[model samples]
Target: MILICKPGSPVDSAKKEIRLVEIEPSSEFDAEICSRFCFVSLDHDPLPRYTALSYAWETALTTEQIKVNGAALAVTPNLGRALRYLRKSDTTVAYWIDAVSINQDDGEEKLQQIRLMANIYRCAQTVCIWLGEPSESSPLGMSLIGGRAIEGEPHELLCGQALTTEYAVECAQALKEILSRPWWSRLWAAQEFALGSASVFMCGRQWFDSTQLIKDGTLNMIVSILSIRGVPAESLMLLKYVGSISLTQTTAIKRLWDLMPSQKPSGRAEIFCEILDQCTTKLCSDDRDRVFGLLGLSPESLALSIDATYDNSMTEVFESLTINLLRHLDSLLVLFTAGVGHPGDVEYRSGVRVRLEDPYLPSWVRDLRRPRLEWMFPPWYGKYRTPFNAFASKEWTYRYANNQLMLKGLRIGNIPAVGLGTVCQSHFYRPGEQADGRRVLQSWMALCDVAGRERGRDPYPHGGFKADAFCRTLYGDFKTTIIMSGRGDFNSVRLQASDVDAIVQSADWAEKLAQYSDEEGEQEAFSIPPFIIGRRLFVTDTGYFGNGGAWIEPNDQIFIIMGCHYSVILRPTNSLQSCTTYRLVEICYVHGIMDGELFDGVPFTGKSEDESTEAYLERTEQLGDHVIEPVCLC
Candidate 1:
């Protein structure tokens, strides 16, 4: 038998492509065969391991009384340097090669078989593609990747563990040969760009040892493999990724849709489509809980495929679903954290917030989102992505309180960020700052200032009083400052003593505490020291003070004062594994003594509690405000 690609499509004749020829299948293929194929590795130490697995496979096959349906065909290039061994049935195993093209015999049948080449590769006992030589990054990473049970296997010899570096190079060079031939060119009849595009694309990037790198590369490669035309569906059968992360069901379905030619799809494509369709069906099951198991998310009623059949018009459907998928993923992340442990792992922390001006967009279309985003934020911070750290904290009792940074980006790629973007940006408040001057609330106010100063926007909730502070002071009253954070273009809200105390006292604390930081000694603008719960509240021009991003009545705030905050360190469990200490600033509302009333009190009161201006950590643990409830973003 000879394999050939259909040549009606355009191609350069001189290039060589992978080809194979086979002798007829034998009824007596049951004859005990010798090694038909073998592993090759440069690692001298690994020789023993490959020798072992080869034997293990042979024994395993023999134990099952496996019989080849036909003469064992070795489909490979002429490179024997990589061939370790191939002896099946005492040399009865037939072979084919590109180095020695098949003789012109029964050409049509061969061409047909070649079209289904992907399927052939998939069904193989194993393709054993070269993984390239291992380098400095591999040994430890490989050890972790390979389970404890398989550690002893001579993977060095069988899997080219030491040759990973060179493997990709060799593959590119070899693939160049396979794709360049007159026969292989026949397969390029219609989808010509795919071959060169895929070849160059694959050669450009290689996987690193980290689990994240391995995972990212695998996903990209799998998508690449499916997108290319004429690639065998079987190419995925042995498609093993180093990491244990499995493809989400939607991903698997998408890959199948992209790679397999459904119209006249061969056995492999047909079967794969069936499997994926079943997966889709399972995702859309009537049983609500059952759907998540199949889709890694809840699936919509139907999926529109992205393929040759799709039109530019179909982009709407794709965009819509993709956004929904992202939203679903974000929701799931929250769901996973909920009820986990007294919000121990649930603190939102500070992270970037990426909101797209136009959620519905196509890549080819120019950025049409500039108008809306610009109006919301200044030029430097508008039209595109802006990152902001949503400051959140865990209870001191919980171990995760140090603070976490989350990075978010949008409209940047076809694959939407899972939380939109994959980057994380986290900064933390120091422990010493938790004093009674409403330190936490001060931190919150500071953020508002920063947001307004840097981005020309306030960190206040939209339509809230704090937003009004944007017009009053670039950096709002110092209880908190929203400053430029590591999260892209977003600001981070850091709490100060006054803000912390007020947050605890007021439920809609975002509003009621507007004038609470007032102090008779307060001046218009002054930076608060990091560790001061300073309580010399100054009387501010509340008569002229602007309200949260909105106009304030001159009578709304008569006096503005500062209050001291209490600090506490708490956690969920005693385990040392996770104990994030939090310094909470408690804010108190204070009233000044009437001018003459101070000395003319009805009866000389004994020294009142909290009268002294010293750090007053209470002797008793305050249970009411000790732990805070996790703020939900949904």
Candidate 2:
């Protein structure tokens, strides 16, 4: 039906006004849901009190009707249920629900409302999260989250209390069911939860305080149950099973919790990038919402220029975002998210390849709409540890022309030989079925051997043993481990030669390989490095061993661009012009030049302590026979 605008106080676009729904009191919960719209100016003093709703717009085709201002309005069954449950018996309630407050059919109004979303949620007296009607296990889930004391021994409890095996299993299963619900996976829910001043989670008649979940250690308790030591083998296995199913949701919740006003970063750019990285796995119906949904959580300085209109094409939206990132951030770390290639370029399993529904977007732009199989660098390297600086301290100079990204860099060498790329079968296969990974590693080793023999040298061009370089390149020169200090905690340290030798020469290599996959819960002491899951090994003409994207071929050229953390592979396009036009293959990890070795006139180690900055630059320009010029990528 139609939502009537106020007689004289229609939405004042200039005053940052919004509409809120007033749900009339009803004694019967099942009675016809009646609501009316009222306008409120956020800029006005003594702001109106209302609760904002955060929920998943269910994808079911079926819908239910509700009366708004005496006119029928269509709504999803999920929303209808939420409205019915939220209705009070005697007192009327106010809500700033997106489905009813904003007219979805009006693009301009939608854009305006989106721009005010942050304030809307931030100003709300409370934010109520609807997790759908309760199931049989919901009471147990709500009880655990509500911090109800569990009956357990001191030793069996997560920190000190002793938990019976049966009780732990019950709690794990209950938490799994709750976390697996659709609400946790929606991208918009994160912004709503993070921006709300106060939030309460409701499931049918059960409710829990979000603050209590943290202050009482209920969330941490659930996490510890999944990973705590000394638990029975059967109970541990069941917990691992639960973790395997709900790891993504748990991670999302933890990330959102960290973004709450208390812990969120102060810088605009930091908040924007953090949200983008953390919410990569979240889902939204419209691809544009990949950026729009998170805008409300970002600082105004970073999001002010990013328009939230639906008229722009997906390619345009992503291109604008990439340009904005380049203009704001100092490093080219954003390029790492560009991903491997378009769909069908790299197969993730035996018969499955990564899918990109919109393949027409520019190559340099990250397609956040699809699931990325692998990133150029591991999370531990970029997040917990200092990233590589392949180009030293050179400042980047770039410009966009004809839809191509042009930047200045030095071409290092061309890939002369390539090994079989690893296919990511971790999600498709279970433990003890990782033969494909072992076979691919064996193939890479053989390729390295052939290259060494052809060069007829015991030492690589970087003055290190060929075997050492190969080993280092396999794991991206770093080792990652899940530290037990907290949930999902990762720590990375540079790999030592002895550690590599011990792993390669171990008698249980095959068993360890079988146990290794990219899955989160299955990581072990000797697990395979997750960084190389969907990458290939390549040897350059200069005898540099590298781990590159799965799309690398024999003739792809390597370049170290200014401000980029790692070397990048570029493939020449079929342009006959004198100036070369190329496509960005992927960011790569080369053993010798990762620490500015190429830029400092050194082969293996970085610039000597005695050399001055000017001396280093002068020597680098002449020693390596390198030339700095503009490189174009379309």
Candidate 3:
């Protein structure tokens, strides 16, 4: 007979009371896992010490039963295994596990507890990262992470000395299994780990200190070892496996580890937008949690007066957050993440037919429910530099009303032609795919050539060969490089003459590789950054070449909004003659005018050389062709 778990008593919000579970001790591994809840006030003289559990909720369907306060409680298999492994035989231990500590059915209590999540983890004596049940190789993986060899044998893998090819491949395979676990992809895991004062990794019967891995440089050392020359064929395969996981998965964890409250630079609060962007690839069952789950890490959450509640709809929550970000941040940077457009909208090679407005949100709001593209211009922080000052030091001036975003900016001309859109990375790298990445790239080159000839400008009007401009525009004029520690870093650097020549040569090399080779390794030699996965190439009516969103089409106007780092594509919603409103297509990268060049010179019309600068400026605002005025975005 299955016994249902009874609801616990309500938490006292006034006193900041929270629930903690005391896992009953058991001598046998198969003994029934029993736990009881106890309420404690965070206001106590000394905070109650417990180990907080950080894990991924792999699924909500409970598959196992555990005894909680003399009643049976349904829990996920992973959580049950975690509890069984953590329960001590000698004495009862207290744990603050999210699944048990808070009543899941009670939204009010969840919200209240969530607001205190940061403190809950911070006050804990330790945070145990449950990476799930162990495999045959799990013990070896744990040992290697702790700077030991297989079966406790001595090895130099982590000591910066060389290891045998056989051991290197074995160790790489073991590490791959551990890093490929689902917990690393979780959004909450990052938050829990960052907020915790101390953290430990536990996998079934084996565990290790997280700091030891960092101090010993195990991950870096392994990467370097695997990259060594003259390795065996099997080791090379393992090298690729380890390298892919390290770049895509483990780097995120390491980055968050660096930003933990204990390790981050002094006096620097985490930027909310940057955090949101970083967590875009993270997994969460509830889309709303994308914002709520990250609030604890961002002080801007409190500054914007955001409340943690499930009462609001997903659209409402996302829209509210976007508006708050724009208003409080005093910049239009929030819009950079918006305008992905609804999935149902059709994108064709010749043109696009967008839905104009999302059913649940204005075009200006970023719907966190959908996948997002990489920012065309990253924020001016850390290793990234924003090369474009499109508005030339002007501050953002705008307001929102009736779900419309009004902004002041000068309209650069519309797109007269658009090239083929880019395809998914799988199609580019994977053999036997329908779309050829080379064909797509060559088609873009063909379009540029045709457009330039049609306009009677063989060389680009920007005074450079069309090929050079196309190559530079494809990369957004930035050089991306991997640092010594395996972290990817990109900076906005002006492409030097040599860099441009090398890019052209690489393009030619890629064309030859595509024709002769089907091997993924050979194809990867000529690759573009993942950022350009869904972007398209386009040429403006006013002689500018750019990279834009896949949904861009002819007649879509580009705008250099004040205080924005990059140019934006805005599709007019009304008649072209008197269009006052537009649907935001997406942000784009225009080649020539990124450095405030559009506003470069003014020939004062019918004015004497003696005219004062102030009078000339006043006259230009009234009579100039490029006037900055309010454009409404719906």
In the range 1-634, model 3's lDDT, one tens digit per residue, is 1112344788888888778888777767864787788877777877767789998796656478887888777778888888888874367777889988898889899988888887788788999998889898788777766544543322353434455666666667777787667887778887787777678888887777666543324455556666573346565456455544333434454455445445332222224455565566678888889878876676544433676678888877787777776655555666666774424344354574444346677777876655456544422334123656777665445666677776666777788745334533432345443246766666666666632333222577657676666666764453543111101323223445575555445535345324322333243323343455666778777667777766776788988876676788988888553337888877788877677766667432433478653333223232145766567788
Alpha-carbon deviation at 302 in model 1, angstroms: 12
Clashes of each: 108, 10, 0
lDDT of each: 0.24, 0.65, 0.64
Question: Against the true structure, candidate 2 has what lDDT?
Answer: 0.65
lDDT by residue (tens digit), candidate 2, 281-375: 77788889988887776555446778678889888888878776776544465566663443333335667554433457666887776544445
Q: Top model by TM-score, which number?
A: 2
Predict model 3's lDDT versus the native.
0.64
Residue pairs in candidate 3 whose N, alpha carbon or C atoms collide under 3 angstroms = none
lDDT of 1: 0.24
**Model 2: lowest-lDDT 10 consecutive positions:** 482-491
Better of 1 and 3 by lDDT: 3
Number of the top-ranking candidate, with lDDT as the measure: 2
How far out, in Å, is residue 143 in model 1? 6.5
Ranking by TM-score: 2, 3, 1
The TM-score between candidate 1 and the true structure equals 0.23
Please report, as a residue range, the 10-residue window in candidate 1 with the lowest summed lDDT.
Answer: 50-59
Compute each candidate's TM-score over C-alphas: 0.23, 0.77, 0.74
